[model samples]
Target chain A: MFIKLAALTMLPVALVGGVVANSSVMIVEVDADDVHIIVPVPLSLAQVAVAFAPDEAKYIQMDSEVGEYLPYLARFVDELRAIPADAMLVEVIDGSDHVRVFKEDDVMRVQVDEGHGTKVNVRIPLASLAAMVDAYDEEENMFRASRLVGALRAAPSGDLVHVIDGDEEVHIRMW
Target chain B: MNRKLLSLAIGAAMLLAVGATAQAQDAGWIHIRVMEDEGTSVNVNLPMSLISVAMELAQKHAFDGDMDFGDEFDGHVRFGGRHDVEIDDLRRMWAELRDAGDADYVQVQGDDETVNIYRREDTVFIEVDEDGDDKVRLQVPFSVVDVLLEGEDNELNLVGALTEMANTNNGEILQVNDGDTTVRIWIDANPQG
Candidate 1:
């Protein structure tokens, strides 16, 4: 009876999630409503659970933000995606430091600024964004690098970070 | 007689100077862009036609590298011969290309679009556009081009290709793959070795 109940419960979840061909790489299809600040450490789920157990409040905030702005951001992301098709709004907790810009064709107009030491500017023209992304990949030695938040998540514990300097130097920082 | 000898000496020096200038003009610059799934990088001063021929040869001989030549163009010819042999020949051929009297810029097709690469012995320079040299400049500065030449996660593979244009860099959406350590790449250029 217990087995039957478990199977019945799992069946719907599996169907809803879609039967992914390979379970090794779990491809989660997150819509706008599911947006969240994801810490992309290469840690196992158990390790992640242990590390994040004390940060339940942080997770809650992320979830709430995702729930509220995901739809709007998704639509917004889609709209701007035509030109800068690969550009995305990475939901991040520390994005307070980033500047936001909106692009009209090749022109990028800065929309937001928190006055962080670094230009926390968002809203890049597709061309500039493409150039930046390309420079980052060549600098970081990756086929492609994610946005700044994704970079942060990848090396959460490391203070030494890599950034493209004037689209030339991949400056490695000790902090 | 002394003045006459001095004039002859000055003429000889001028002729030598002209010879040096002519020698400098022997090699022309070509722009080569190496684009991958992640992004595109513009390399300048490279003999575009020579590299284009090398790329053609690699395609014909199936030479494997960070940037695969086959998938670059629609009408590209596949490299069917031995990889090592063909790559060596192409490299040799590239070295032999004479740049004399050619335009300072030769546009070559990268893995994606046509890019101009300025070739130099130690570094390759790239500009955004022919005219906008002041606005954009990138040096082929990496010392480890080998990493770019050979990689399992390269764009040639299905996964990398699919994810090539998947995400944008405007600090918005983050695709957190809790698998491999994801490197945030800005430019799509071969790793310099």
Candidate 2:
């Protein structure tokens, strides 16, 4: 009888800064001229949330089908890891935007400059990205997010992304 | 005789009330939340102890401690090639699976659909994914299965299963996401949330 009442209710979804200090956490902060927000989420909670996400959010689809490139993800990451840090993977200047993708130390970094105090920077450990990619479940056609959560526990801790756009600034860090 | 029966009813009710109050103070709660994108949402919070008290009352009055449900569900419980097995056989298989510990039992993959049945620790999970329109995840503890299968033929011990669930830790039991609508059932310690 109680289970039948499920159609009549909803849940509180937002989770912020509610985990142990030593646990792996992802912090997202947005500071604008008008508003400020910060959310610190544990990786375990992220995995649990994935279980509640729609299928579209679980799988990464390309032109032909979902996870079509899964088989080659490891190989691609491996090749990238083998490249020298001094090598420039991609550099483009279009209009006022300047983009650069390069290997630095053990991680790959991408920086985008839009001029006038607008800049976007992303740093990701190649190994950690590969670990996340390996979590894909071939049978389910989706990622087994729990595995990704487990992998994130050992990932290098630091700022993942930082962006400054005019009067707004956003930062994402994992630790 | 009427007076005696009335006194017994009052005593039982009072006993249940006291027990429920004591348990509710410490026991966990079961929470269910369902929502739809750009639509109304609902949240239901039920005390685990309250359900336990109700189940105790039900055991004394309705089920009478019976747990064996008949092995004739007359339904198809698909498990790869062993899709058409009997209920008793399925239980036997479950026992085997549980003994073997955590591992994938069945995996069915299609062009636009997939189903996975696996066991993790003391729980079993059945997950179904059909493109972007539908996704369902079912999680049940091993004890719930044992209690449910204890009933006599053709009957499931739903009461026992629920009783076992009341004892389960605050964790997720089931979740379903279909397009705009999402439903989740979990247990926690907060009675108000």
Candidate 3:
């Protein structure tokens, strides 16, 4: 049976919470036919405030002016939550220093620092994902197949991590 | 040297340069739009020159590594070796099978039954039969089939045909209604002089 390509419009939803100050990292792996995304989520408001509060100065002022920071933090969390979980079977592995998030039965795992961030791992079929994304926006569809493979090919061996600006809509890095 | 001859030659050369630039600007483009009943739509624009460049690049790297086409049209067509053989290889294989008369209908093994693919004149038919019962039959035009078959060769014959049709037929290239979704592709040519 031919699968119908549908647009995926589910944005991340916000989990009600306060903001905390913390640091965190996200990792993603793109394979031949699948994509694995891993993100660390901080449970506490202080950690969430610190990890995704736009910037350090704004984060400092967040405590003084709570209203201005709450909405931004909520939006960030919502975007993170918007990462599609339907296409993946998720598992959360909690540790003392870090949390490990991965797809069920996936052998690959990333170590996370404890109390730093929450880790979320999602595995998606690359072809299906590309088709779905293409159904929505053809111009951006190529990134799923072409740019992804090119980036994976160019990535150096070893645990290399490159941090882009945190304020970006999707702040994912490869490790 | 005669000044008149020199002036004429300079003027001719400038005219040729301008003609070349105009030709470059007049090159055709394909626009594909997919729409669903749910009010979701997507638009894609593909330049003919870019497709030509990608075809050349694919030919160049056909034996080593992977050749990626358009970013939005995306995906790598890997060549060389058995393990990395991609859709391009499969197309050639199917075409050869058809040529050899062994594939008037190709049988695909399913979980509990067999699916048969055969061509009837201009339409390719896919029929699924499970446990001695006919399950499903689908007929698709040869135009769409040609797109898939000729895709391995990096030729956009279907798009070219659509471009020609759009040029003549009031900008309506072709539209296919599969269930509730409609897919339309046309050529938005550079305005004529």
The 10-residue segment of model 3 chain A with minimum total lDDT is A86-95
Runs of candidate 1 exceeding 4 Å displacement: A1-175, B1-89, B94-116, B130-136, B142-193
| Tens digits of lDDT, candidate 1, A132-165 | 3332333223322223222232322222222322
Candidate ranking under DockQ, highest first, comes to 3, 1, 2
Model no. 3, DockQ: 0.01
Q: Tens digit of lDDT per residue, candidate 3, span B88-131?
A: 66677666655554235678887877878887665567665555
After aligning candidate 1 to the native by TM-score, how far in Å is the CA of B71 from where it should be? Answer: 21
Q: Is model 1 an incorrect, acceptable, medium or high docking prediction?
A: incorrect
Q: What is the C-alpha lDDT of each candidate?
A: 0.30, 0.61, 0.38
**Candidate 2: tens digits of C-alpha lDDT, residues B106-150:** 899999889899989988887877777666666778898887666
DockQ of each: 0.01, 0.01, 0.01
lDDT of 2 by residue, A1-175 (tens): 6764653442222223344444678889999987999998788777767778887765543443336554455655665565456545455555566777777877878898976689999987777878877777766666665667765755678888999999899998887
Deviating ranges (above 4 Å) for candidate 2:
A1-19, A48-64, A93-97, A151-154, B1-193
> Which portions of model 3 show Cα errors greater than 4 Å?
A1-175, B1-26, B50-64, B68-78, B82-96, B99-104, B107-116, B122-177, B186-193
